[model samples]
Target: MGNQPMIVMSEDSQRTSGDDAQSMNITAGKAVAEAARTTLGPKGMDKMLVGSSGNVVVTNDGVTILQEMEIEHPAANMIVEVAQTQEEEVSDGTTSAVVVGGDLLGQAEDLLDQDVHATSIEQGYRQASEEAKAILEEQAIDVGADDTELLEQIAATAMTGKGAENAKGRLAELVVDAVTSVADDAGVDTDNIKIETVVGGAIEDSELVDGVVVDKDRVSDAMPYFVEDANVAVIDDALEVAETEIDTEVNVTDPDQLEEFLDREQEQLRAMVDDIVDAGADVVFAEDGIDDMAQQFLADAGILAVRRTKSSDAAQIARATGAQVVGNVGDIEADDLGFAGTVSQQSVGGSQQLVVEDVEDASSVTLLLRGGTEHVVDEVERAIGDSLGVVRITLEDGKALPGGGAPETNLALELRDFADSVGGREQLAVEAFADALESIPRTLAENGGLDPIDSLVDLRSQHDAGQSSAGLDAYSGDVIDMETEGVVEPLRVKTQAIDSATEAAVMLLRIDDVIAAGDLKGGQIDGDDGGDDGGPPAGAGGPGGMGGMGGMGGGMGGMM
Candidate 1:
């Protein structure tokens, strides 16, 4: 084997090592970051992603855009994961996290070119990340549960430039109310707050319901359209007549026998209705279907019944009304019933919906969001979701920070000072980490049509002047105090973004080689074929079908 290249791997396998591997990974990560950079601030633009099936999603939510892109590059996918993790952890700052992660890789590339070891850069980044989180924690302002104004500001900030800016004020108030209504000493559970979007009215028409709104109608038109002082019964089982599980045949010797059999079925249905009436339940939400006979019985009893309700809706109603879900109709009793001040069937967007409202000691609430069109409603829903998340996080953590890129600028300034204290090659890496964090404010300025360099300079000067809350106002191209501007975000958003972005960056930096094995054809591996293959498919592992490591420079160009 003297000087001969060993062919232990398949001939079709491709390998990228040294600087080439690092460059390819960095390029992919940057592309992923750029895909979300434009959707950052109050003046940021929206992305209209058209799926292969012609489905279009119009919004600036970073996680939504990344998830819809269906990215195939392994490195790019890692950046997307950073956004996803941020979204799951804080429900906001996904765009900021992805952008920061991409910029960190970009900054590390400069160090690599200067012959800095990958381990040194990774160590420096880890150190900077921990310190950055500490700075954010120290800078956060304490928020109390009674601070309604501050909570609204946090919600409104999350909604800015995400397609609900036009009605953020009203939406923010509703978000705060919905979140606080369900909050307890333990913490706030966002899942208790449901959002129902209807396309037919202006965004300002959105309102908060004290209880729950389910997208279901009365099982029978004969039932009362509305019931006041309602005792609600939530049923997980069907109201229909039960049949024997085993196959059985009954021989009827006379017509009277068949008539008696049919009469028995009617009696069974009436018995079910009687159980509900006996329980003093004026409203019924059934997870399974209600028989026609049961519907007629309920209607005659002046009871409102909604059938085929989703299990989630049923559970929410049970929580809202303080009612228990009964599995058997016969088992329903007054003790198992939940009370609602009113249960009504209202027509919304030309569709009927059951609204259960005004429950005492309610634990669940709903936001009825209205928009003029389907697409508009969809974007509004996304905006409202983010707002709810931030508000819930703020209430839970009881700490928030000024928004509008204020936290990033402050973190950058502090990290630079920290770099000066540590005099070594790692110091250069720490300073580079500081520069990468400045990308947030820079991207915000660029997306708002302001000069990034000028905006960044102004931000640094403001920080140096001891005004840590000062940040760029994207709409006015001015640096103002974010807290005074009513721009605030949960402290978790900033810290989580820093932690996730830095982890992703350090993980990518530690990589020095990439080996891909597949049946390479025309310099591209087939992503569709994976059966007893030597390695994973193109998109599954490595950069096989993504035009190879060197050819992936332009792979994410069409993401937006």
Candidate 2:
């Protein structure tokens, strides 16, 4: 009953029976819950979680909070799973998951007082959660299959807080059309398209074209002869080299002296022209005006040079090309090509065309715009992101099931029916599980604190009457309650908490040995607390507060 090591057992190292592990789980689950309690609703405040090293995470999101809490307890880790599962089930309901899981533990604790066994509670709780999940899935709102409404909703919402609402919509339409067009084209690669925007241009200047835009002319008149494989260069500094390594005052006596200086300049220019020619760069973009001598030298080298090109254009060219030609000469390589193909310049609003021909494949891209203003664009992006995340989650876990609480709900109802048919502890528990699933809507209604019950009831009635999207509700009452509209929540969090708590409490009651706290890593209880020197400790609960207490509330307030 004593002399056990106090090392915490890693979950992988432990194989304790499910019933034997519950005692420690109860506290851990609650500890996880505490981490997310503050951020629950639109009115919910964000928590500035600071880690030991001072990294700060500021968010009102439930999942983020729980995830941020550095928890070390095994039982507390389970709550994270519950939230993760809920998040997977429904994109924006992580808070509901943790809250419900915590409450379920709380309720289960009461059950433990009434002598329920750990196994009994585990089976019952899981059964109830599964049934509840099935029920919610049945009532989920379905956007019409062939309807463009969802698409429009996504685009429109993406621009909501974005500025230039009308402009944003127009841009989104253009983007959608462009992407759809690319998709329909046989020769085009849908994934290859990109949208590159430059902010210095005016709003009227923001037009889309088939190819890349480079705001420069040919580097020099003698640039390449229609390069089939172009190598573009962007020189940020003056291509001319500095006078000499040593600084000296020059004394020019006459025009002949000036001519001598000029000759030296031409030599430097000739060297630059030779490098470009040898490097096989089809185009050279320079930021400053090219001297007549330099221009003439480039012409002899058969290289096209564009002088006075905007520095930004030069940068884009450098990025597009693998060649480097800064202050002096540098080698160009075949691997410098970032894009597989380039587009030839078709003058669009004064911007020069970047002609790229011959690629292994094609690419397509569409940029949805919310507004011209930065803030509006940000909000719109956030909304669209929410929808994307939601879609991803649904596709991953919740496949389309038979409609309208028809199969699963009916099956759940029948389980309850069968309990009436076959009487047993499990039978009763299974039936109760079905009822618990049904309670999700009820809790939603209560949270809404409105006639959501009536609205939800009507929705079900409407479904019975052949109404579509019946799972969606018009504002029934409180903002949170309106979640019944299309929120499709899982089982209430409180119920999960109650279940886990009871399971833990019952498991703890069966402990007898005072093995060193080694098993406590996962789920542990004081078997027989031996006081120091081989005597029994007066208190049996061991030292308190060893539970891991991290938390997260998956993000909340996401749109669409």
Q: For each candidate, how many residue pairs have backbone atoms clashing (under 3 Å)?
A: 0, 68
Please provide, for model 2 over 495-558, each residue's C-alpha lDDT reduced to its tens digit, 9 standing for 90 to 100: 3333443344334434422233443332122111222434322221224323223222212111
User: How well does each candidate superpose onto the true structure, as a TM-score?
Assistant: 0.89, 0.47
Cα lDDT computed for each candidate against the true fold: 0.85, 0.45
Question: What ranges in model 1 sit over 4 Å off?
Answer: 1-14, 242-261, 348-351, 516-557
Structural RMSD, model 2: 12.0
lDDT of 2: 0.45
Model 2 stretches astray by more than 4 angstroms: 1-24, 30-60, 84-92, 103-114, 124-146, 151-383, 392-423, 431-474, 478-544, 548-560
Q: For candidate 1, what is the TM-score?
A: 0.89
Q: Give the TM-score of candidate 2.
A: 0.47
Model 1, total clashes: 0
